[model samples]
Target chain A: MGRTEIIEKVNTVFRDVFDDDRLLIGEQTTAADVDGWDSLKHISLIEAVEEAFDMRFTMLEINGMKNVGEMITIIEQRVV
Target chain B: MNYTELEKNCTRSTEGFVDSCTLAVLGTGATQHLAKAVKGYAYSEGIALDVYDADYNQIDAQVLDPNSELCHKSPEFTLFWLCTEKLYEEFCQSKQRSDFADTVIQRVERYWNLVNGKFRTNILQCNFLQLDDRVFGNYGNKTADSFIFQLRKLNCLLMEKCLAHRNVFLIDFCYLQEKYGIDALRDSRMYYVAKLPICTRMLPEAAKQVVDVIKAVRGKIKKCVILDLDNTLWGGVIGDDGIENIQIGELGIGHAFTEFQMWLKELGKRGILLAVCSKNEEAAAREPFEKHPEMVLRMEDFAMFVANWEDKASNINYIQRTLNIGMDSMVFLDDNPFERSLVKSMIPEITVPDLPQDPSQYLEYIKGLNLFETASYSEADRERTRQYQEEAGRAAQQCQFSDYGEYLKSLEMTAKTEAFDSFHFSRIAQLTQRSNQFNLRTVRYTEQEIAQLAGDERHLTRYFTLSDKFGDYGLISVAVLDKQEDKTLFISEWLMSCRVLKRGMEEFIMDELIRTARDNGFDTVVGEYLPTAKNKMVADLYSRMGMQPAGGGRFTVQVKDYAMHQTYIRRQ
Candidate 1:
């Protein structure tokens, strides 16, 4: 998948896990940009994203990622 | 349902539910996800569950304290999710390790006593999932000091402990581990990051296990399984294959069908009524059960059998009416997808499981559904199929007489009514939970509560058993009269099995109730009817039995003014 495609799929995961239909995310978006993106929901978000992309995240990557751009980069590396 | 759907259901509104229950969840680890999953699953089951999730790792503090939040909520059920990972950690730290199972059971007993002493809530304890540390390789099975050995022993000890406590029940988490495997149910990374013990993918199933026990305890259970013939019970079409060539024995691909029949026969022995609904001739259907030496299910095993060319939906409806059980309480299994879909679409309440295309996977698939979870069982359950067969006999004999009263009298019916004793506690409690249609007031009690009522001087409890020339309906009805102020006896509960309906059992019970009231020096007998979606059959029962209405569904009749009901049942 391309960067834009990964971002679009990740956006859908965010929308679903946050229970928001109108949620939109960009490469520069961080946890603070999304409502209800606390530590508990972050786990659910990681699980949903892994399922959506058919990939598992490393423990360090899951904890250290700060922005949606980094997540998209990780997905871009894994998918290729 | 998947984990995402269950999490989404957590936010769904439960405002319109007429049936609701309160549950308090406490765990040695984090239980936020499990509690959410339980609430979501209960919503899917159409039960409004108000779940109180305790703070993480607070099972001891919350249970030991008398004035804690758990006590304030006073939930109907208190679930203790004791995780094996936490238990392993305790084992690593403990100096004395050989008796780990016994020590852990002692702690569990303390928690049970503390909670039971404070409230009347039912305790649900999750058993340990047998996770092997592999320190001793395969020698763990023989070594008592091994973690795997202790875990297995702990599960068995928990079952024995629960047997002694009437209010305690096990969740069978170890069985789930065996089904899904450890890798699917556990995530070490998630456990380290979050205190959650069960993986997110497995939460819905774990929640379902909890909800199944709760549903069974609340009297929602499946009583009968309606089966389809052709490839469902055997290998080929009996009508076309001519029975002798049809495969059901030790031949190739026939072992699966034989094993399937064996499982169904065991279910029949467990008191689940089995009926045949096939689309073949009656002789073709009855031939294999009668003459085949390899067949596990005989003619006597089935309570009812119907074989014809009629549509399966109509046939299942007829079976439901004849069995007198709710459509929701019946599971119809057919190997044909067309029939399964048709039955599902026609009767929305009935449970129709889609059989796999392969016959070999039939028993394995049904075993995972856990469709027959029950809360209580007694020796009376073994006689259930015979009772239903006798009911069929009575039904067939009813057409012989034009007068219903004369038919009842000619049956030579006799009833034995006695006060609640230790021998009938399990069956009495089971009746109180299972009887819904003919139940007035619909008050459910557990065995512990029934024993308490039997011992209390303010209450008089009676359980009635009915029999005829055909067979016996063991512990068919129950009535509890509470002594009130002003020399009045209040009928707190009156419920009877639908199998014995229209057999003069109601009149017989009422006669006994009035007689007991008069003999106890109570001048008035009061009865009440609390209406539910299912109990409408007994709405006017009190009035029909000569009790005058006193408003608010309460009926009263003076002991002196009460006339003896003429029933065919002679008291034993």
Candidate 2:
């Protein structure tokens, strides 16, 4: 998937995880970006994305996602 | 919010919702109507019913008559052969069906298993065993102690067998019928007649009722019946008649309200939040409820109290706000139908249990109600009364300060917000499962899914705990904040305890959420409101906090312009 495609897939993950459609997809969306987005949901959405994109996130990298921008960067790095 | 996403969450993925049942009815009524109710309720929750057969005549005919078709229906049908009034014990002693006796006993054993099993559908009742027979009548020759022992053995053994694999239930219609007698059964709303015994009808609907009660028992029951004082608590209003003049104890209408109070209090003890929405001035109502020698409910028995000159609907609304419960969670009770009708028209969600015109049937009427059934009952149910009492105390303590902010500060309120850990996951999951009133989004969840959510970083689950000098509320609130973009927060679920409804804990949590978002350069926070009968308190929660409704009641509290309230000092 291209960058836009990746963002679209991640946005769908965001929309699905938070149950929101108008969820914006900037370069910096993070756990703090959405409502109903908390720790109990965070890991599953990541795992879902990891499975969806055939990518994996390490504990260090997973913890490293400080913002949406950081999440996209990490997912992008893994995708490549 | 998208309907498709909501559908996917509810239908496609059963991740966040635990089907928490509210009531578990145990009765032995069988009719098509009862059956339909049973089936419908079962689809919704869980049920436990009993089955009995009337007039050993059917069994008698089956047994003594050789022409009975089931006589030769395999050796298993030999039990049918023994169904005759004459052949029961004789068949037990006979060699005619000795070959099939073991298998038949094993099949009969299955009913016992289902009776004792979990996921019991409800009881299916047929008819009472004949008065002359061993199951119903005095085992004439047998000792009472031995009969009791035999009954225990029979019931438990049968429970083990019947509830064995099907997760079905067997109601003990025989027990109650024997205890209260058939006369009382005639008055029961649940029982219906199915056979030749005109007055003593067959509860043939037991099969279907079990299904309906089970389903009805599945979801949470939001509303509860709350009582008043003076004549409401005793025979006459204390203010009008004085304490000594108030009639109570085993006398006339005095005993009536006393009995009614006992019933209301009992419901409170059973996880129902009982509020006192009395029209009387505080001293009159509170005096009898508190100091009346014959009073059943103490001040601590009630969850919320609204005592002032106000319309009943307005008082109810205040109680709804104070409890952080929805209009549907409240069932208002007063002697006046005008007030009841007025409140009913004003707030349609608040249920009004029909008050008997005569005080004699109050106890019996309340007893017949199956409103309290639900899929799950934890220790929290027993503690609910205590919790609400404690919440009331906490609110009362907040009154000492002249300024609201000063009062909030004086409470030494500490709120801890964090990701779900093993310690709080079960309860966090429970909030998703049970919270109806203040919840922003009513998404129920299972423990396993909670664990899965904890393990997944893409979804974040956080719990909020509120405590002041009064007491710590443990983990009473939870919020599901998800990432939408770098700057947008999509709120999935937000709920605070009914105990701490007015404590501004939700606001504290929102403020913290926005602070977290702002600290990270987020611009806006999104929230949704999916209306349930019990959560209208938070319908305008976002709007009150500055977020306009996007559509319907769905809205967002933004971060950039929103100034976090400094009154609530965050511990986290």
Candidate 3:
């Protein structure tokens, strides 16, 4: 999958986990950019993303991600 | 349901729920998600759950302090989730590693006593998940001080304690870990990051385990399993394949069906009624259970058996009516998806599991669903099948005689009525919880309360047992009479087993009640009928027994004016 395609799929997962249909995401979107994206919900978001992308993020990778750009970078490196 | 779906369910409004329960959850780790899952799952089961989640790792503070939020809320049910990971940290720091389980059990007993002493609540404590740190590798099983050994010992200790304590029950967390592998049950990353013991993927299943216990305690239980015969109880269609050709015994696929029948037989022994509803000639369906040498289940094992060309839904409806149980308390199992869907569409209240295609996977799948969860069992449970079989015999003979009075006389029934004693306390309490349809006022009592009533001087208690030429209906009816001031005797409880209904049992009981009132020097006998969704059958019971309506669902009859009701049962 390309970076743009991964970003679009990731955005769908975010919308689902947050229970918001119109939740869109970009490369620079951080935790601050989303509502109800606290630490507890972050775990649900990670699980939903792993299920959607069919890949697992390492513990360090999960704890170190800074933005949607970093998440997409990990998915990009692992998907192809 | 998944974690996200359960989370979404929590947002739904429980606006019109008629039944609601209060629950308090305290755990040594993060339990907010678990509380949410339990509340959401209870909503699906039509129970509005009001959950009070204690702050993380406050089990001691909340249970010990009388003025804590837990004591103030005083939930009907309190859950203690003591995880193994937290216990392991304490185990590592303890100097006496060999006595770690002992120490923990002592503390657990203290907590139970403290909470139960403060208020009357059902305590649901989670057993430790059997996690092996693998420090001693395979040798951990034999090592006394190993974490795995101590953890398993702690689980066993919890079971023994729960068995001794009447109010304590265990959530089989170890069994859950065994069902879905430990890898799926626990997430190391999530545990470390969030202090959540159970993984997000497994939260719904854990919540289901909790809610199942609560449901059983609240008298919502499955009492019967309706089975399909052709491909369900055996390998092939018995009508097409003769009894000799059907796969049932020690063969390749036959072994699977045999094991399945064995499991059903075990459930039947455990007080669950079994009935066969099949679409075939009656002779053909009886051939295997009657003549086959390798069949595990016999004809005598079933409470009722119906084989005809009728549709499965209609046959199941007949079984439910004949058995006199609610449709919600029956489970139907069929290997054919078409038949399953038809029954499901027709009867929306019955539980019909989507059985797996492979015959080998049938038993495992059914076991995983845990359909037969129960809150109590007694010695009477083992004789249930025989009682139902006797009931069937009575039904068959009733058709032989045109007059019901002749049939009752032919049976020659005799009943033993005596004051409540120590020998039958367990069964008496079980009847108070189990009987619903014939119950005048549905009031549940625990064995402890029943014992207290038996010893109290102001109360008069009687337990009745019936036996005829066919068999014995042991401890079938219970009545508690409270002596009121002003020469009045109040009937606080009157409930009989549905199996003994319409057999002059109620008449016999009313005679005994009036006799007891006269012997005790009470002037008037009073009774009440409080209606429930299931107990409408006895709404006019007081009036039927010649008691005058005293308003507010109460009835009164002077002891001197009450004539003895005629009954076929001669007192023993």
Candidate 4:
């Protein structure tokens, strides 16, 4: 999957986890940008992203990601 | 079964919580995900719950303090989730490994007592899973005072303590560890980051165990197993492969089928009814049970065996009719995907698990389904299959007599009825929770509630067990009469097993109620028939039993004018 495809797929997961269908996630999108992306839902969002990408994310990798673009980059690396 | 799918399921909200119960989760680490997983599973089981997830590592404070949210919520169920990591930490700090077991047991007992003394809810606590330590390696089992050995011992002690206490239940962390490896169940990195003991990927599975307990207690248990014979109960077709050729014994691939039959047989002994719905010749189907030397399930084991060329769905319908149980209470297992799909599309209520391609996976697959869940078990459960089989015989006998009343009389049925006592309280409570079809005022009560009602003098509670030449239907009917003001007694609960429905038990119960009302110096007997989605069959039960409608689902009978309804069943 390319960067744009990964971004589109990742946005779907974000929209689902936040329960916001109109959610548009971009390179600069962070937890603060989503509606219900608190500490608890953040775990669920990361878990959902991992499942959607069919890969496991380490705690360091999950905590280190500052925005959606970095997470997508990591997902692309793992998918390859 | 991943967290993502579970989270999606959780998104489907069920509002305004009718049939609601409260649950409090007290864990050492992050437990909000557990609550979410539980809510998702609970909604699927038709339960709207109010779940309280205590703050991380506040199990002690929440359980001990009277001012805590748990005390205010007063949940009906309390779940204590302490992971093995916490126990291992405690073990590492202990001076003696042998003494660690006692310390752990004492600590658990303190929590159990504190919760039990403070609240009335049932506590579900986890048993510690021994950590995979290679320091002692495989030699840990041989060491009497090793940490692994003591942890194993501690688990046993915890189980014994739970069994001794009426309100405590054990969650088998070891079972989960075995199913999914310990590493999969735990994530050290996540634990350090978020204080979550169980990994998100594995939360749904663990949460399901707790949800199943809640379902069992709430009377959503599956009662019957509708099985397919060819390639399901055995390896191959009975028509093509003779009884000798069909693989079903204790050798090779046949062992899988044998083990599957054994599992089904054990379920039969545990009060789950078994029926055969097969598409095959009757003689060919009967051959395996009759001629095979190693057959575990005999012809007598099945309540109803439908062997014909009809479609699988129609056969299942026939089986449901013969057993007189709701379709939701039945599980149909077939090896062929087409047959399974046919049953699924036709009877959407029946649970049809997706069977694996290989026969060996059948047992494990069904075990994972957790179709048959029950909160309480008694001696009555063991005889459930036999009683159903006998009821089938009675049904067959009724065809011989032209008149239904005469047929009932010919059976020479006698009922042993008694007030709610120690011996039958558990079964009575089980029936009240599980019986949905014939239930009037379908009110579910826990064993604790049943015990209180049984002991109260103001309430007259009775359970009736019917027996005939065919066999015994153990504790088939329950009645709870509440005495109101002005010499009137109200029927708060009136439910009977569907198996004994058309056999004049209703009239017998009405007669018994009238007699009890007169004996208690009451002039009027009132009855109620509440409407629930599953209990439409008994909507007009009050009027059918000769009670005059008194408006608002209420009916009345003047005890002075009430004559004993003639019935075939005589009191023993």
Candidate 5:
């Protein structure tokens, strides 16, 4: 999967986790961009992405990503 | 199912909402996720649950403050999920463990009294979760004075206190911990970082349980379990494998089927109507139940049994018609995926749970679904199955009669009507909450409110229980006549169980009401027919029962001209 494909898939997850279908996730989309994306639900979003991608995110990878674009790049490398 | 799915679903806006309810959550720790999950799950269940989440660890301020959001919300259901850290703090401050337990109980009592006095919502108090004790370790249970022991005692005491209050309900989180495991339910990292005691992963599961309570309180509970015979009940097809060959005994693989049957039997005892819908020769399908010595359920246990080569969905339709219950109140269980899917597609309202491939997991899966969550249990509930079975017999006998009037008269039905007493209070309140179709006015009330009405001299509260030659229909009807107006008796609430419909019981109760009005020297007895989506069947009850339409869904009968419109029911 390329970064675009990963971003496409991850956007669905973002929309689903945040419960907003119209949510458009791009390079600049951060936790602050979405409603109900608090620290408590951050872990659940990561877990859902892991389940969707059929891979596990390291604690470092989970904590290190600052934006949706960085998360997509990490998932791109993992999927490949 | 999981927290993410629940959260996502909660965010989606719902249309065509039915049975809207308000719920407030006051937690000692983080509970916003739980509130979201609850809204999502409740929406999926067709309940538009508006949840109010209080500030973390500020239950006292939220519950006690009159100007707080909780006061403004005044939700119909209030859930309190408190962790043991605060209790532990109290324990450490106290000199003795017993003193700690006593003080905790006192605090809960004070808070509950304060909350109940201020608001009218039902309080769902969760028991303390045993988050491991290192003080006494394994010996904590052996010592009554230990923290763990005291906590257990405190939970029991909380249950006792909750039972004493009609509005307070203790939700057993300890049982949830046992089912899902303590570690899975509680996340230490989330607790430290976000103050979330219950893990985000298990928030959906917890919220599902809370919604179950809300569903029961709102009287949206499943009443029947429609089972599929053959592999669903036993290990194999009874026709292919003979009664003796079917796995349903104490030996090896049979134990799982036997345990499942035992659980179904227990459910039947608790008043959940059991029926069988299978595709086979009726005689062949029933032979195992008739002849098998190891069978835990007998033919008498089932209220309706349909066995034929017809499609299972059609048979379920037939069963629903015979039982006179809504499709939503029935749960169909079948081992075959095709049969389950067919029923699901045809009768979407009926609950058709996905049966696991393994038969042993059936018991745990059903228990986890909480399919039959009941708000109140009484002696009447225990007699529910027997009454339905008798109803089936009556239905069978009705087919032989030429006319419905002759059939009702032949049954020798009689009813004993009395004021709402302690014995019938819970059942009356439950019936008022749950009864929809035949309810003239669909007004729901709690047990405490019913008790007050029963005691008030101005209100003439009557609960009717019918018994024919077949059996007793335990506490089937309730009528509250308010005499607050001058020389007028107002029928504030009147509802009856759908099981006892079309039996002349309505006429019999009307006669009793007329007699009461004459005895009390009232000039006019007023009644109403409140129209709701579910209660359209009884929209014209007042007009049909010979009452003049006084406008605004109201009707009145003059006491001097009140003719006893009776057919069969003999009052006792």
Candidate 6:
């Protein structure tokens, strides 16, 4: 999936996870941007990524997931 | 990073989340461990949730108040059901059935109905129904009878409603109460304030009953009925009692054993694999099954046999291996709890149902399980009994032939693939859910999704049913085909029942799929896999089939790369 397509997908997952339909994700968005996006749900965000893309992520990459930018970079590498 | 960027990056990952997922309910304490576990499940399985502590103070108010905030906010999944034994106690202990029974019953009924009405959504209610302190006190026989009747009816009604949801999981606290007496619910860790608690840690005895139910949800009940020997089937020990002394058909205990064995035979005759694991002398065990005219189960009836003196687990393992299937695929039964415990400790996967105390309770135990859950059976499944008998016949005859190749030639096996139709639909559905060891992707699907895929032009689902002179292993394998722009055929789901694995039926299906892809103007055939624990046996299936791994176990072979010259070879 392209960056734009991936962004839309991420936004949908974010809304679902945060239980707030209005929640939208962007390149610079961080965990602090959304309420209830705590350590409990951080793993769900990662899992949703793998299922949506049919891909796998290592612990090293997932642990450093500070912002959407870093996560997208890794996903880009995987798709290619 | 922005959410968009995170989604973009994460979307392209080539691996799935963490390893195993264990749903840990955070009791009032241990919130930290529970949070970490939920995070782990989410990270691993994509979604993990914990109790939000709704109805913390006023459960009745939260439930009964029509304009309550929670009543309006429809939850995605109702996390916890507040089955407050304390609440029930408070209401009942008020010295007034007239004061709250009508209102309490109404609200409780509505709360249960709301949760169970939706399938795929679960309400993890702490099933704290009990006769704990005041209720278990002296009551007239009539009053106690009515109380038990109403409570049991409510439980049955709640369970029936919960069954509607495919994902509805009953974390059985009721079973816990059965194992551990109700007073254990008073443990401080499990119960504090208004909470009446029972847990695996506090109530160690009730652990298995609760843990087993959760673990079993990993797959459907794969094994049907576990056939027992001696007192369970034949009324007496064959070795000690002798064949003539064994009860088969007569008065008293003979009739009970006969009826139970016949019921088990019927279960096996209907696609449920039947096997025996008895700790009796060989002739003594064989005599009743083989020569006794009144016996319900015969020698040729059972699919796998183990009458040796080894641990039941070891013998069961041998039977499972010889049959080439998972241990979870068999249910082991014995008259002795020692043997039962041995197998339970050794093979945690097999379902070891508790043998009833009385001999008459045997049939009730078997019927209570509801093992046969399949709504539909294919043409092939109807002939399962005869097919198993034939497989046994083949097994016996193959002993005479030394060479595996010669034995293979004698069977004259045919390799033909049938396109997806109503005929093979349910069987294909079963293979996906039932098959474990031989599955690569091991993708489970609902019947609706399967129907759409089968009807679509872009996908072709096919099942391979193998047969020879012995008998037909009906629709024992399934493969879902996907089409790419350049006529590339992608293997979405591929699995074979382990019973049919050694017969080269996998290669046969692959050859046919490759041919179908070629005829459809496809250039290459690809094998795709999604990881699962029970399906590790097929991790190298694609590479072993001579297809080059395109990447991460995705093997794509060109039509020119395909070869069909191989003769079907199976070990005798």
Candidate 2 chain B lowest-lDDT run of ten: B74-83
In model 5, where do residues sit more than 4 Å from their true spots?
A: A1-15, A19-80, B396-407
**lDDT per residue, candidate 1, B134-161, as tens digits?**
9999999999989998988988999999
A2-77 per-residue lDDT for model 5 (tens digits): 7888888988988777777898889888888887787767977876787789886665666678998788777777
By summed lDDT, the worst window of 10 consecutive residues in model 1 chain B runs over B187-196
Per-model DockQ: 0.63, 0.01, 0.61, 0.55, 0.41, 0.01
**After superposing candidate 6, which stretches have Cα over 4 Å from the reference?**
A1-80, B1-218, B224-228, B248-250, B291-294, B365-379, B569-572
In candidate 1, position B333 carries an lDDT of: 95
TM-score of chain B of each: 0.98, 0.59, 0.96, 0.94, 0.95, 0.64
lDDT of 3 by residue, B1-572 (tens): 87887777778899989778999999998898899889988989899999999999998899889999999999989999988889989988998888899999999989999998788788999998888999999999999889998888999999998877766879998888888889989999989888889987798999999999898877788899999998899999898888889998988999999999999999999999999999999999998999999999999999999999999999999999888888989999999999999999999999999999999999999998888887778999999989988988898899999999999999999998899997888899889878889999888876767888999999999999999999999999999999899999999999999989889999999999999899989999999999988999999998998899999999999999998888899899
From the highest lDDT down, the ranking of the candidates is 1, 3, 5, 4, 6, 2
lDDT of 6 by residue, B134-175 (tens): 354444223533344345445565566554434344555566
Q: Indicate whether candidate 3 or candidate 5 has the larger lDDT.
A: 3
Using DockQ as the measure, which candidate wins? 1
* lDDT (Cα, 0-100) at B559 in candidate 4: 93
Question: If you assessed candidate 6 against the hidden native complex, which CAPRI class would it receive?
Answer: incorrect
**TM-scores vs. true structure, each candidate:** 0.98, 0.54, 0.95, 0.92, 0.92, 0.57
lDDT of 2 by residue, A1-80 (tens): 56777888888877765667788877866667677566535544654576578876666665566877777777777786
Please give the distance, in angstroms, between residue B70's alpha carbon in candidate 4 and its true position after superposition: 1.7
Q: In every candidate, how many clashes are there?
A: 0, 126, 0, 0, 0, 25
Give lDDT: candidate 3, residue B272: 96
Candidate 4 lDDT over residue span B117-148, tens digit each: 77788788877766756568888888856788
Cα distance off (Å), candidate 5, residue B207: 0.7
lDDT, residue B40, model 2: 34
**Which structure is stronger by lDDT: 3 or 6?**
3
lDDT of each: 0.91, 0.56, 0.91, 0.84, 0.84, 0.61
